[model samples]
Target: MNENLTNAQNIANIVAQEVELMSALVQLLKKEEEVLVDNTPDKLETIVLEKNTLLTQIIALEKNRNSSLSQSGLSPDAEGMNLLFSQLSTSSDVQNNWERLLNLSSAAKENNRTNGILINRHMVRNQTTLNILQQNDQTASVYGADGQSRVNSNSGRGIIAG
Candidate 1:
């Protein structure tokens, strides 16, 4: 079981390093989101596209990870697969993959927030349209002033009446 224990220690170290890398990437992504908040819609599209590519890679790696762990059971304990995984454990590829995952997550969140902004804009526009139509219809009616839009007979200039 020494081999398993040793492999476990190495795996644990890899996991810890991966976590740290991912965390740093996450913080960077958050800063990027803030920077992109004021960006035009087209620029945000580029981020989303990049995020999607990263997401594809992250998903593939995640799928392979579990299989790797299970198969580590059968890999030669001191050579071959162990060396392969050991080298990869500290390699730039793993770090990059985690970094990409963080970027994708943050970009997805920013996209959702942007969608919310668009929805609110549409809702406000629709309401303004409705109010304008109502006023127009009221002004064009039989009694020139009968349906004149009622101004808030009460103070409505942002005064709290309650």
Candidate 2:
């Protein structure tokens, strides 16, 4: 009925949708973890693509929510959101939804971090295997500004003579 109420509802809906997306992201991350544990790198590409798409959707929805908040003369920050909620008649429900959304976001972030660690571990293992196969045992090598290999001081002796 009231424009402010309508704006508040829109914001709520956006947040709820974001929470849904984040939930999906968490699921995807869990699936990725399973795939990683199984050493199924092939499945990861598809999962990554799905994650990127969900991320894009979440970003777009956030932009829309910000626009809605701005239109309602809100700052689009935490304080502004609190102020907006205080002004809304549905404050209690909206606040609850916001809290849930925040929790979901935090959980998603943690899951994503775990997935990243898993990925890094997989990469390191693969690199180590490759190095062994190549018979190159160097502490580590760095890429130079020109994208050339910069040998580490500890490169005591490469399996292959340079």
Candidate 3:
């Protein structure tokens, strides 16, 4: 029973850290959305770096929590978490923290999805602009590779005074 309590405490601590990191991730995602909307590439780059770091930390905490669960002969899934909570004396606090972590994780996922849509929209707009520029270049060029003037027979403009 003592061992079980220790394992439960360890798992709870890991979950608390995960929740904290996940909350930071949610806030970062909000900043990312703002940066995307404002079209600030510089700020976006920095935010991406920060997000990566936070995600790394969160992932590590998750792994630690799962490992602790496994060591306790648990399955490291919702079922295992439920079993652990049910046996714990402080189940309410631990269960509430786990729920909060899940909610924050969901928020981060949605924000990331929104940012992906914004990035895709920007990519399409950029590609369209590039295509227009390429088409104009092909039609507007008056000189050939040998530095000779090339005339377009389909232009319908003829020399009047030459």
Candidate 4:
């Protein structure tokens, strides 16, 4: 029973850490959205790096928590968490932390989706601008390969050669 209690406590601590990291991740996602909207590429790059590092830490914690759960003969899912909570003398803290983690995860997911939409919009706009520039370049045709001014017949303007 002591071993079970110890395992429960360890899981609780891991969950708490996960909750904290997830909260940070959620905040970072919010910052990412702002950076995207403001069109700050440099700040967005830094934020992406930070977000990746934070996500790595969260994944490590989750792996550790899952390993602990497995060693305690529990599945690494909600059922397993509930089982661990059942074994604990005071489960409220861990339970509450788990709930908070879930909420933060949902927020992060939504923010990421929004950022994706923003990125797609930017890409489409840039592509449209590039296409317009390319079309104009083809139609204008101001210079020839021999460095001579090439008059575009379609433009209805020719050199006076005065």
Candidate 5:
């Protein structure tokens, strides 16, 4: 099973990198939320494209994780990358899909509905995280370099911390 360990380790490494990338993208999305709440949509098209790419990366990671498990005879830990992937299965797909509904550019995508759902779910979770930070008066601590607090405000949506 050393080979399996090596393979699992390799896949785990890739999964970890992808997970980090997704986390950064999620942070970017949260920043976009802050921008949308306080600023104009001066370059929102770019945001949408970037958001789509993040979703693609997330889905790709999920597929890779599952494939690795099957190929390496390694049952993924229930709380490891599998758990991270599970978070994506939440409601963000709805929001992302809905966003596409308003964008003619995304109308041609077949998985628009699924993506809308995922994005919405993701935003909901992000908002919840911010809310917890706020309720505990930890906004400053969470918003490193004023990043957390500045981006906290969801413009009355109460989803953001600012």
Candidate 6:
């Protein structure tokens, strides 16, 4: 029983860490959305690096949790978690932590999906702009009524130009 309690505490600690990391990830996703909306590329690399670090931390915590579960003769799956929760007498705290982790994970997934959609929309819009610019022939420059060279209204390409 003491061993189960110790394992449960370890599992709970891991879950708490996972929850924190997921929450950080969600925050980073929100920051990414801001960066996307504001069209700030300079700040994006930092956000990406921070998010990667958080992911690495989360993965390591999950590995530790899985090891704890395996030591308890659990299969390190959802079923294993459930079994461990049932076997641990002081499992209420662990269960609560696990639930919080799950909620944060779900939120992170949804926010990430939203960011992906934003990126795709941006890509399509940029692609359309590029297509317009590329289709315009440089030799076909038109002269304005004042005899000055008329600028191509659709010409737009930048660092992300592809």
Residue-level lDDT tens digits of model 5 in 1-162: 676555555555555555455555655665566555554567667878887887787668667766766666545543443433333334244334323322432332424454455557768977888666666465445555344454556567654577
| Better TM-score candidate (4, 5) | 4
lDDT by residue (tens digit), candidate 6, 67-126: 999887889878889898888777888788888888888888988898899889889988
Model 6 sits at a Cα RMSD from the real structure of 9.0
lDDT of each: 0.52, 0.82, 0.85, 0.86, 0.55, 0.83
TM-score of each model, in listed order: 0.36, 0.79, 0.83, 0.83, 0.44, 0.80
Better of 2 and 6 by lDDT: 6
Alpha-carbon error at 63 in model 1, in Å? 0.5
Better of 2 and 5 by TM-score: 2
Overall local distance difference test of candidate 3: 0.85
Supply the TM-score for candidate 3: 0.83
How many clashing pairs does model 6 include?
0
Looking at model 3, report the run of 10 residues with the lowest lDDT sum: 141-150
Which is better, 4 or 6, measured by lDDT? 4
Off-target runs (Cα >4 Å) in candidate 1 are 1-32, 73-162
Order of all candidates by TM-score, from best down to worst?
3, 4, 6, 2, 5, 1
- Report the number of the highest-lDDT candidate: 4
Candidate 1 residue-wise lDDT, 10-117, digit = tens? 544454454544444454455445545544445656556655665555455444444455555644322433454454545455444444545655655675576567
Candidate 4 residue lDDT tens string, 1-162: 677777788889999999999999999999988888998868887898999999999999999999889989899988999888787778999999998988999999999999999999999988677556455575564554454656646766676797
Selected candidate, larger lDDT, 4 vs 5: 4
Candidate 1 achieves a global lDDT of: 0.52
Clashes of each: 0, 0, 0, 0, 25, 0
Error of 4 at 22 (Å): 0.6
Error of 3 at 132 (Å): 1.2
User: Model 4 TM-score?
Assistant: 0.83
lDDT of 4 at 159: 68
Worst 10 residues of 5 by lDDT: 98-107
| lDDT (Cα, 0-100) at 42 in candidate 3 | 81
Of 5 and 6, the candidate ranking higher by lDDT = 6
Residue-level lDDT of model 3, residues 48-122, one tens digit each, is 899889988988888888888888889888889999987887799899999999899899999999999999999
Ranking by lDDT: 4, 3, 6, 2, 5, 1
